[model samples]
Target: MKVMIRKDSKGTLSAYVPKKDLEEPIVSIARPQMWGGLVTLANGWRLELPEMAADTALPITVEARRVAGGED
Candidate 1:
């Protein structure tokens, strides 16, 4: 298994090793986006995903980690 040692802002030792990454990298996907069926407002445009419409929103946070390999 691979281990990725890192330190947090609180100054603590930590190791991060994703379950998928442990078995080496696998197939990656990159989809293309088309500008069709897009709505344009006074300032910006938006796309609606009626299929994925939800009554509430979820909180999201971004976390950065330094890996030993190349940039991801």
Candidate 2:
């Protein structure tokens, strides 16, 4: 529902968090509980998405917009 964010020295995505309050890290609103998905790496150190998420996002985006009255 919300995001708490910070960037590392090299501009990589260090964390993507959502929480009730900031102080931070200890609080989580979009905690791993609801946002669970497969996480992998493109080069072992870099991050990649699992096949399911990779395959699902685009169609799901369309479906969500349709439900939201934003798409046909």
Candidate 3:
């Protein structure tokens, strides 16, 4: 899935799922620190997702990391 990360007027960082609209984000990072690094979601899904360019009009493709003991 291609994810879109954008900054709101209040400066909150949010990730937009293509299927869903920007008004509702797939996940919202606590801070910008998670932008370039690996992030573990509340549901325990870890992703090697990275932030893309602000000026770019492309969505990013992310792969969800396999859980330690979970089936692929």
Candidate 4:
């Protein structure tokens, strides 16, 4: 699925799923840089993000895999 990753003004990380019309704050990250790892959303969905540069810009949309979550 496609997920938009962004940082809010308060520096909180969030993920927005366009197809689902759902947005949730990222509660945990499997890796410090957050790339090539898993991120858990506040709603309990786990998504695997692709590898990217450590300095990759935010608010960017990228392809991600839904590792664990509810329907779709």
* Cα lDDT listed for each candidate: 0.26, 0.24, 0.45, 0.92
A best-first ranking of the candidates according to their lDDT comes to 4, 3, 1, 2
Q: What are the runs in model 1 whose C-alpha is more than 4 Å off?
A: 20-72
Residue-wise C-alpha lDDT for candidate 4, range 7-63, written one tens digit per residue:
999999999999999999999998888999999999889999999999999999999
What TM-score, to 2 decimals, does candidate 2 have?
0.21
Q: Model 1 compared with the native: what TM-score?
A: 0.25
Candidate 1 structure quality by residue, lDDT tens digits, 1-72: 333333356544233345434312212212221112222222221222122222222221113222232333
Off by over 4 Å in 4: 69-72
Those runs of model 2 whose alpha carbons end farther than 4 Å from true positions after fitting are: 18-72
Displacement of the residue 71 alpha carbon in candidate 1, Å: 32
Task: Give the Å error, residue 34, model 4.
Answer: 0.4
lDDT of 3: 0.45
lDDT, candidate 1, residue 33? 19
Off by over 4 Å in 3: 20-32, 40-46, 51-72
Worst 10 residues of 3 by lDDT: 63-72
| lDDT string, candidate 3, 1-72, tens digits | 455555577765455555534233325343455545555443444445655453444343444332353112
- How high is each candidate's TM-score? 0.25, 0.21, 0.41, 0.93
Candidate 3 lands at a TM-score of: 0.41
Name the top lDDT candidate. 4
Residue pairs clashing, model 4: none
TM-score of 4: 0.93
